[model samples]
Target: MSEWVDVHFQALETCGKRARTAANMLTVEDVFQDSSAKQPADAAQASMFGDLSHSGALAGKVNDVWTALKEELGTGRSRLQGVEKAIDQVETNLRKATRAATV
Candidate 1:
């Protein structure tokens, strides 16, 4: 005889929804659009201070860091979406199996 396992479909659905919502909210544009660090660094690079070679190097470093952060956020969003999809699939499969067994 196999052991019976209880699965909470509603809770899984809720968790999937939450993960999707979180993933949607994790966009780079939304998070970094109004960043003070980016604005100042960009301004500094575009202004007279940019004439200095050292200023350009510093600006480059800042841009690199900014790009890395955006990439990380994108990666995180992708992972969250993947998890949400997997959860949805699991819920669907479980429900189908339960129905088939009852019939």
Candidate 2:
């Protein structure tokens, strides 16, 4: 019985890991689907997870999702900053253009 209990525990941990992954993916998907302009919050539960009622596991999954989203937002912001800088340079160069250059 004890051995079986350990096996069950391992199974639960695996389930938890998979659940976390699904929740994270759902979160990103929602971001794209719901509000294409803003990042979405993490998922705290799924159909199976709700049945298990493991609130801790649910919250943990949400945290994992949130962290992943935060990372993605950071990357996106970095890229946007680069593009903005490029645009600014182009505008400055255009404004500074001489009549001779334009002709």
Candidate 3:
């Protein structure tokens, strides 16, 4: 049972790491996407530049999404930390219980 509990905590740790990595990736993606600007290839196309207000708004929306994801990732990390503490307590209790049974 203790071994199984250890395995579960390992899985949780991996999940937490993945969540942090994904959150970091989202930040990088937003930076790259924001820096992107569509340019016309020729004089005629330059004169026909389309309105980019919508693009700006869309980018804002995406940034908002990234912010939300980061918040969720933080929450997940906190939960994993709590679970790890709980697992330690459980293992301690199991040790005591085993000792009592042997006595």
RMSD to the true structure for each prediction, in A, is 4.5, 23.7, 9.0
TM-score each candidate.
0.75, 0.38, 0.47
Ranking the candidates on TM-score from highest down gives: 1, 3, 2
Q: lDDT of each model, Cα atoms only?
A: 0.77, 0.57, 0.57
Better of 2 and 3 by TM-score: 3
**lDDT of the structure predicted as candidate 3:** 0.57
Candidate 3: worst-modelled 10 consecutive residues by lDDT: 38-47
Q: Relative to the unseen true structure, what is the C-alpha lDDT of residue 4 in candidate 2, on a scale of 0 to 100?
A: 62
For 3-25, candidate 3 gives per-residue lDDT tens digits of 77667656656665665555454
Q: Candidate 2, after superposition: displacement of residue 83 in Å?
A: 1.4
Q: What is the lDDT of residue 92 in candidate 1?
A: 85
Candidate 2's displacement at residue 82, Å, is: 1.6
Question: In terms of TM-score, which candidate is stronger, 1 or 2?
Answer: 1
Residues 20-97, candidate 2: write the lDDT tens digits. 444444434455765547553445545535666776777778779788876886566555555555655554454456
Candidate 2 deviant stretches above 4 angstroms: 1-57, 99-103
- Name the regions of candidate 3 deviating beyond 4 angstroms: 1-51
94: Cα error in model 2, Å: 2.1
Clashing pairs in 2: none
